[model samples]
Target: MRLVTQQRALALTDRTSSRLASLQTLRSQIEHSGNLSPAAFKNQAEILLAFFPEIESIEWAPKIKSGSLDSFERRLQQTQAKTTQLTLSDSESSGIAFHLPIEYQHRHKHLPLQHPPGFDLIREAQWRDAIRSAIDRNMITSTRRYLAFAEDHPTDLIRLFLPVFQADTSQNQLRGLLSLELNVKRFIEQATQSNLAQAVPFEVYDNEDHNKIPLYHWPPAEIFSGLDSPLEHKTVVLPFADHEWTLVNVATPAFIQKYQNRLPIWLFVASLLCTIAVYVIVRITQSLAERLHEESNDRCWQLEQSNKALSNKMIEKGTFENALRESQDRLHDFIRISDDYFWELDTNHHFTYVSKQIVQFTGFPPTAMIGSSFLDMLHEEDSNSFRQALEKAIPKKRKIAIELRCKGHHNHWRWEKINVRPMFSTEGHCIGFRGISQDITDTKDELELLPETEPLLANESYGSAQQAINSVADQITSDRRFAQKLENFIHRHKATLDKTREAFFREALPEVAHELAALHEDAAEIGADKISELAGELKESHYKQAHREEQERLIEQLESHLEPMMDNINQSLHRQNPGSAGQKQA
Candidate 1:
């Protein structure tokens, strides 16, 4: 009985795997053809249906851009091909950007179009997921159970979508989709048609992450009756695109009953022979015990070797920790040489700590700078503005940068730029400011000579350009009021607008006006801010532009040093030079 059951299981598995593999091969053939014409689509479906009769219908649902739909529809009409007219209702087309129009749908062994030519496949929820899966995975994907196409037969159906990419755009753009609808009930019947398979009942389930949900079962009613342990039976994993399905074949009640009825007679005959074999069994047991004792001794030697390996691993762990410490030391050395020095402040805006690099620029000891109020170091006029900015910035936790003149140890003022961000405590209370300050005295001196270094555009051209942009912005703002009046006029005289629309282009003028109004609104939305920004850029004097450029150059120089510090430390610890693979390895 065991031998017979194993043979039946193998037969069921072979049939199911072979069918799916053949369908996959057909998909490859269609995809490689380079052109997805209606004829090519229908031809492939016809061939698949011959081998896998369980497929109830096949469809070629091509995705069309909204801009191309009207022209594509007109081209179809010109061809004079047999088709049904399917237009979306006003509400259905709203807010949809693309349409999956069914170009060809064949069903029931015939090439008849089952749906209207342009019926949207994406409207159905299940088909929408199947479409998404195909595009996301770029492979054939199957949908969960959905209602069957035939109204009278309420059987569950599974749809699979294989994406077709356009040759011109290659894999980046999807040209269309090829889909198949399988009747689940018919699929089971076709799979288990053999007499051997029918003798034992089985079930097929979609195994998503090892969670089994019955796709089809024998005796049909067993599905609703529920399964306690589908995995307890003889289980097999049927691989599908991006998922696996579980196939379980079990012994039927009749097969079990027949086996039980023959079991008792065989047991009775075995009992009668048991006394005759007792002396022979004792001799065999003594030989087995001697073999077990030899194996136990071998296991003790293996355990002793494992202990030596553990001791070697501990030595390697110590070596790794030593290397880690060396890398950290190199990181601190890099930070010490950086020009931009770090500073931290208390909640009262008094410096709590400053890096030693600050002494190089200020000529003040690090200890002397500690506990000094940040505002007191700035020039008096700049200090008042800086304090007001910080007062507003703290509550909002805003990032800020300010220029100030600080007194050095020689009693000379040096220009500096400080960038700071508000820090917070674990409980979200305002803690203090943490920031980096860089000396910019040399940069400020060079920038002050910029007007003599570089020539500027003539004031005539710059001033006129600024005035022109500002004028256009004001005109657009005023035109928007007239646009509203045009809409109101059209709404108040709909009949007149409709008559004028038909007289001009056989379409409603009011509709045209509304579309034009939408276009105007879009123009206003885009033009206003863009013109204002242009005016500001044009009005920026030569001095302001030069000053901005100088600041950006200084920032780039500072970042160049900071960007590679960690990478340099890693290379140093690992004993590598630049332009070598060590930088790449890190």
Candidate 2:
């Protein structure tokens, strides 16, 4: 009977082994097929490993004699068949299938059929339908493998339950019931380094045909190893119809309590000494740890102080940067207001900081002006002097002034005076230079206003002669109002002459006055018409006339408009720079 039970255990193991091999095949195929990611395959592989450790705890029938068979029979029952199946997921509600019989389920099969293409899903592609059918068949095949073992053995129960408890397309209820979890709490509770144990699960399949059978477990732990010593055991029982079969759990003995030989008095004393040494070591370690903790805290404090100092330095640097920016902005505003430009030059004579006023000065951006020498804007004749001043400034570290007419950019001829002064670092070492250029065109214009040098002396004598004639005419005007006396005086002188006593023919003056008034009106009208006509011609000919012709016309107009002004100016000059007053003083 024992031999037969051993054979039965081997058979159950073979069935499970075959199923595991087939699962491996499925995993390999899924991997090489390139349909799943490496991570996904690894996750699925881990799930399979989770299922594997359960197999180690499986129990087989114990030793039995000819009479033991009857004892076992009395304990169990014959022909009490254990029926089990696997349920697989599909496009429709999955079905449960058996591989061999209802009594054993250690062997599982592949997947089963998918539902007919989702009514609408079919019309789209026949290929998808075929793929669905293939996957479904694989699942159904997996289901059958578990059924074979369940049909034969009563002990192989997980194969029967897990398929349904964790069936494909399972609801939450099945997942909770068939969780298949082992309560490792026992291993944790009654545990010591000397006594190690692991909680294991047992499942029972009650077959209707009560055939007494054995089952196999692999990769046995120390408790399960019959060769290992000092075994402790626990039993779990489930009642069948008219019989109850038991499952045995085993463990290792406590290593510390299991004494193999007697110890000498000296050895016992040495063991105690070792224990005291360990306690001393522990105390020293604790003291060292406390000291290390204190040192770490002190280091943290020092680091915090240094960090604060660094942060303050950063803030101070930021403030100084802002102040420098404000100063630069103010300097730029001053240059702009004065129609001036400034720049800095390194010893290599490249502009380091070109001011924005350069745009107004040269019609080019400051960026364009940088990297150019100060001589770049100088007139050809003044370049030598500008270079000389730059060289002189470098040695003396003094301000050097240069005057030059910059070439007209955008038709603007600006008279600029460059003032270059050497710059130095705080150590009084030559760093570079700063130079400001001012537009001095107005100064030049003021210089040109020396009226005493305008060559008016050549016209002075003619002006004096004309003034003499004008004085003589003024004297005649005062004496010219003598018409009333002139007529009588002329008559008396003629009468005194007594020669031509004939009546002086006195013609009527009335007709003559009216004719003279009519002549004056005609002359005024002619003059007014001529002035209007000339003004129209001048307006039409504007800009089209030759420059010389325009100038001539302007001169003629100026003579006409400024004759009175010239006379007034001459009178003022006569008062201020008066020749007669000087002559009288002489």
Candidate 3:
């Protein structure tokens, strides 16, 4: 019972430690980069919080020197569009002489609305101490339990602080601090959600505090009160990030009754009955003892000879078992640390085993993949090929290697190289397959980018360009207002040209020529050679009045080519940077 309680405490402690380590890694990365923008920091925090539900919020407070405080405040006000000030309370809670202020924060949706920026850290003793310790020791630190201000009310929360230091700075100059706030109740629940925890009611107390307040009480006091006195109680000390917690676990009445051992009582009764029978047998066999003694001695000698032979056989069997176990262990270790993932499939093609490394390439845990059909993870186009290959190889008990596309994270298709050999039973009958899978997605992408594959590369580029042109065409066709405005401009220009040819040539002719020349250059750049030629002809015809009818034809040709030329330019821009093309168009 004590062992079970201790295991639970250790499990919770490990979880806390793992999250803190991840936070420390994040801080180190930011420190090395020497810059932490709010958007980038917030993005990282959100990702961490998504994976670790125990964390409630992540806050980053950059260090601000006294000389730059005013400038920092002005910048903050501009970004937030409000009057912002860094507020410091009269009390000096933090041991440090200087105070730190909160700047940017990312929080879970369950948390209440965040307070405006410029929150002074020295206002709270717990947060202040955590920050001071992190900076002084150059290590991560955790705050004592405290009430956090929420929109409706205050909530109990604990915070961890990791100080960020400036890269290549003397004395390891402080750059900022990253803090994660965790809901105590939620953290406790997530840590002890196993079935064993349900049967064992537990309470966690903070040993660091003088009063020894309870941090969490499992199976709330109300429910615990209705249950009978526990059969046994166990205590465990859990250490986490500079704080010690005492965990007390008690077996529920139902659990005690279900698992209580009665072997001792049964053994005593059995011994007494055997003793009475022995006495009766002794009296009855007293006369026969002399006769049987001689026969017993001979039988004992024969049994001893047989026992010697059995012991030798047992030793050989033990040696074989130990050797096999060691070999299996070595194989598992290799699979765990290798870049590729090892896997096994049953005769039905369902996964029977998968290494933990699979998570790196597939974004899925081993437990989630087990028992799932291997073919289900393959791309539809590659599924049939893989199945056919397996079928042909399995019958011959031969090794098979194939490259196929598999569904990966976010349902994205990734190329994988798999090599497998069929497993056989003692009788040499095929039973299953063992394989290793390597993620070759990057390799495949690199090959596609190689200049040697001109035909494939050209087709991909052409497809992307065509898609971008179609997107522009759809937008233009849907915008009726733009079409109406262009029609108005053309009508007014034609009227002016017909009313007074001499005046039009003197005033509008130069402006038209300039616009045509600009269009000609733009068209040439986008590979619209036909549009460029038409525009150049129109520009040259502007200087000659003899080709009046020819000028009208040139204008019609330019108008017809203008829409396609614009589409081509839009496609060219999209090809340069597909991500921001929509934003550029807007």
Candidate 4:
């Protein structure tokens, strides 16, 4: 009997503890919705009903100001809900600063409560006090048992109050309140339905104030007399959200009678031992079967894990390959836009690959340059020297560099410098060479433009050299400026065509064409006939080619034509400084 009583007590404690913990969840539902309107409260109430069916009804009684009372009434009218029997009288509301009403309610089917839309709660002093306390304490508070008009008769009910406030409002400023109206008889019936509570009678009440009254009783019969005796029951205090409710559980008369009706205590102990022995024997047999089943499951689990690992590895490999391909594409794009071209040579020193940039640099397609020997493209005078350097460097797998002249598609010899490293296999056998080649003609011209002089400190020789170089640079800058002005003029007319196409052809085109014609005549007078010829081509193409295409074609031809004139000027500087040229040639 004592063991049975202990087991029931422990079970009741666990159930009560779980119920207390759920109070936070209940309070959170109210707090999370922010300011509750009818629709919002109804939605929350439906959620509570689904989660906790023991709840008879849920209510939201948000605080309303008397000043906003008319606005609040209009809002209620818009919802068109059923009205309550009484409205707040003007006299009653005069000093009432705030009015909390049942704005929303969701009632259970079995225990329905008709909470009309504007049922002001201020009339109920106990409810008013509980709400005020909850707001003051900034926590949940409960009212004593009260009679509710739910079933057309006075039904005993207790309400739990949780105050609401605007999230940004200070704690002392209460915005509204939420109330849960619990049917006392239904609540007790539900609590008593638990496995342990059915075997015992329990009563729950506030510990600090006996006058505050018990909230619920497990058995309806225990409501008045079952909690009267202290010697016959055990008590537990349920600490929940700033309030403590005392739980007193006592064995029922029927429970004690059933225990007494059992066989002698000694016989009961012997029977229990016999039953435990039989249970152990059955458990041994069950363990063997379970072991066999687990071994089969283990093999299947291993196969599944292996398959998943293989699938994951394949996914990782594919992702890595995709990333590598994207990086290669970006690298190729960089090479194409640059003034340099990448090249690769086989073991025989024959070109296996040349980048697309070769087209822009040498006026020769990359396809035409592939499979050609690197030595064949070099000027005859430098080929042997370059070949010797490669032969010495390849054997040691070292990087090599060489500057030589290559004939462009236009039959012009331009200087190019190649920087290369040998490619090797894992076994250390030389596979080929990979390198970048860049146009160095401009750099070579600048080097030739230097004055003929030996290295000197702050002396007259250094000053003279510096002045001479500056003079040549000024001439070069002047020539570049003229070329830039001509290009800008052509581009400006092309842009004008988009805005005034007919006017561009009639006025702008002829004016630019005549200017080029005059410039051509002036260039011939100056003995720069190459520049003269380029100007003549630009003037002639204005009538024969499309305006846009001709603009681009003329610009390219003019640039190419201007390069030779600049090169000639650089050569003239080199001739004036023979020692500088001689040093470069050596």
Candidate 5:
């Protein structure tokens, strides 16, 4: 708003000049041995922009004439080159443009000549500074004459520069001034030294007598009243201060006349374009929303399909697991009922399973047969036949049957009828086979107990009768020997009796004769033997008969002694008798 307002309060001295300023700055840099670009012209814009606005007018912008800028830049280079041709008339006392403080005493060169010799820029600047300051004082003094117009407003100040000639010397020097007076709404008091660094030259005017035309190198500010414009804008970007603003005020007469009838026509066109844009945007937005809805429906369908598939897979797996469990249970029950043990083996014939039925028949738990191979548990002689049975089964793919005894758990052998069959896969390749061993122990024992007939019976009878005859003959021979021994013993007894009788009579008569001799020799002594003598043989016949009776009694004692020995021999003989078969059996 400040810029819009300031446009009315400010006007351009010449858009032509400012545009030239920008072009000249760029062209100069390009001609020199330095890098260059558009932004380098910022200082040129700042310096040229002063003519467009006063400080308090609010709006400011450069009015640049592009065509004028190119023309003037080309003209300036040609004019400057021609002016500095070093003609014979040009002396060492040459005039140059500069924008620095001057050395007061030296007429030409500055005292502090810090720059390179080719450009004595300081000395040149000194002359320009002295001349501008002198003109500036005079211009301000003259501006007082226009004080009436700015009574209620602040003064606007600006500066510019150009060369002027004097009658006294062939060089440029001080001249009179041309000045303008204006008032502004406000002063941008916080602007810095650098902000106002561009050298805004003052205008040097001719004196009122018109004796000389002085160069107005510096510009003087001009102001206008009732500055309200139809549509103009301004901008201020001075350095070293926070942004501040002011809007310009002016009378409304010019605005009413310029825009009176044309406003509605433009407004109608703008409204039509806006309606079309809004309708197009809404159509595109609706299409995007429909596409999003379609995508969401597709996502939901995919999720539903995945969930159904997972559920079906779970049902299938559960059914398979249940069937497998039932099959296993039935197999175990079959083994239990048949009084048979079942086994499974790998291709290498290592036992993989030994059923519980094995424990019932073998008097052990299932573990007893587990890890036990078929041949390892069979009787040693049966292992070869067992292998032959497996070989037979493998080729024909038939049930291999064998009767072999397995070492029972009770330290005995059990007869088993093992039936092993070849098992093939659907491809008809053999992986392994199933087998069952039934306990046939009772059948074995019954066969053993059955009576022998034919060959067995005939050989046994013949052997028994031969043994009986040999035993009887040996007994008869022993009995005869015993009888002969009895006879010899009797004869030896009879001889011994006779010799004993003779010895007893001879010894008895002598003992009695000696005892009678002793009695006669003693004359009348009583002797025990003579007094105890058999009544003294009073009767000879009685004496003879008593002697005979005594002899018979002795013979009877001898016979009693012989009888027991004879009886013992007879008992031994009876024991050895040929008919005593019962005794021999005992």
Candidate 6:
């Protein structure tokens, strides 16, 4: 029972240590990306907080220079739609050189807490000391217990400060502090919430400061009132961040009564029975002595046979080792000579190994790529497809081949074809993946350009459409009302086509297509063959792939044709009525 209780205490310690280490993920993200918007920070913080229920909140306090404070406050006011000031309490406090204000905070849904923007963290002594230690050492540091305000009241919370540094600066200047606030009592309860924990009450204390009270205690001390000392006590040291916590497990009187041992009573009863059986066994041994002597001589022959078998096994082991060495050598040689770079991913899809050839292809050395997530290298649009493909292949232990766009050096995107097989342990559990990626950017571009039939048809149709528009302008030159309407029609659609390719593709193209179809019917009703033919041709042209650069080029060409038509209409209007044209121009 004592052994079981000690093991549980050690397990809880390790669990807490691992949870603290996981906070580095958030710290690394802030360092790599620099400043994160409130929305982006909240999204990431919520993800991490979901895995750790003990964490009450995550806050980001950026290191605002004195010169930038006004601008920072102005930005916060605009975002929050309220007056925000960088507030500092106890301005007379000594050893306070700078102040950092909280800019973003994400708390648990159950905890209705609000650490509004511009709330300075440097006001508190403990938090200020922790922030200084984190920045100076460039490591994560923890503050002693502090009271954090919630909507209704205050709660005791311990905070960890992780320093973030500027990624692009040569000096590696401090950017901000990322903090995680946790309730130690709740953290311990969640970590040791098992059947064993119910029997073994425990208390956790900060070993660095023995004068301080226990960080968390399982049961109230009142339960042990008027009771005797504990039956057993054990302590386990848990190292996390910058401090050590000792988890002390105690087996009290109640625990002893609940799990009492009966081994002593059973041993005494077995001893008396053994004495009675000894006399009868002494008489029986004399008759078996001669038979045992004959069997001992036969055992010598069997031992000789076993020695020969052991010699045969040793020879087999040497041959197996030689074969294993040759296999590994061949694998290394293949990776060295291959033009396509090789990579290995752990079960979480993080890169564990990359060949030196990676530098030639992606312009990133093996060291830079290692330990980074494979999904981070992929383009946003392609990440989902790769994940879906991997999910389907993993269950069946099948190989997957996919083409994806990967972000290379300087943020340039390149298409790559990846062929990978899932690696498995001897027990048939999936361990990771080994793969080779070949650059296929040129091949993909060629395939996109292969469809020339549609472009040729489009060119012929656009030529006819341009000529028809010009012919309509000449025929309607004499009628002022008709010319005015034609001019308005051209300008309205031209304005719609002038937008960015992405905007036109997603929003303007559909409306323009519908209007052109209407124009085709109007021209046919007015008995204008040329105008009707042009509208019909345009309405029939395919514009499904609006995201393509080719679509943007087409819009530009159409606008060029409209420019000439607009010029011709203006000239015709001037020739038709010199007096009216001059008055309108004036």
The numbered model that scores best in lDDT is 3
Q: Is candidate 2 or candidate 4 better by TM-score?
A: 4
Q: lDDT tens digits, residues 50-74, model 3?
A: 7677787776766656555656656
Query: Could you tell me every candidate's TM-score relative to the true structure?
Result: 0.37, 0.25, 0.39, 0.40, 0.26, 0.39
RMSD of each: 35.4, 33.4, 41.4, 24.1, 51.3, 35.9
Error of 3 at 170 (Å): 5.1
User: Each candidate: what lDDT?
Assistant: 0.56, 0.40, 0.65, 0.59, 0.40, 0.63
Candidate 2 lDDT over residue span 1-586, tens digit each: 1221222223233334333343434333342333334354345434443434333121111112333333333333343323321112221322211121121112132322112111122232322333233343332111101111233432222221121122234342221101111112221121111111111212122232234222222112322432222454334443321223333333333322332232243335434443444345345434544553454456557867898999999999999999999999996678767657778988767788888877767788888878887666767788787777777766444576777888646766779888888888877677888988888888988878868656433234336545634543443345543222322222222222111111111212222333323323432332323333433333334335435455335324523432432343334334443774245334
- Angstrom error of the Cα, residue 329, model 5: value is 3.0
Off by over 4 Å in 4: 1-17, 25-53, 58-73, 81-113, 147-155, 164-178, 190-404, 408-410, 419-586
lDDT score for residue 433 of model 3: 89
Q: By TM-score, how accurate is candidate 4?
A: 0.40
* Model 5: how far residue 437 lies from native, Å: 1.4
lDDT of 4 by residue, 104-174 (tens): 44453455434556555665676667766787787777777677665578777667777666655555555
lDDT of 6 by residue, 183-248 (tens): 876776665554232455667777655465677766765333111334567666777678877766
TM-score of 5: 0.26
C-alpha lDDT (0 to 100) for residue 349 of candidate 6: 94
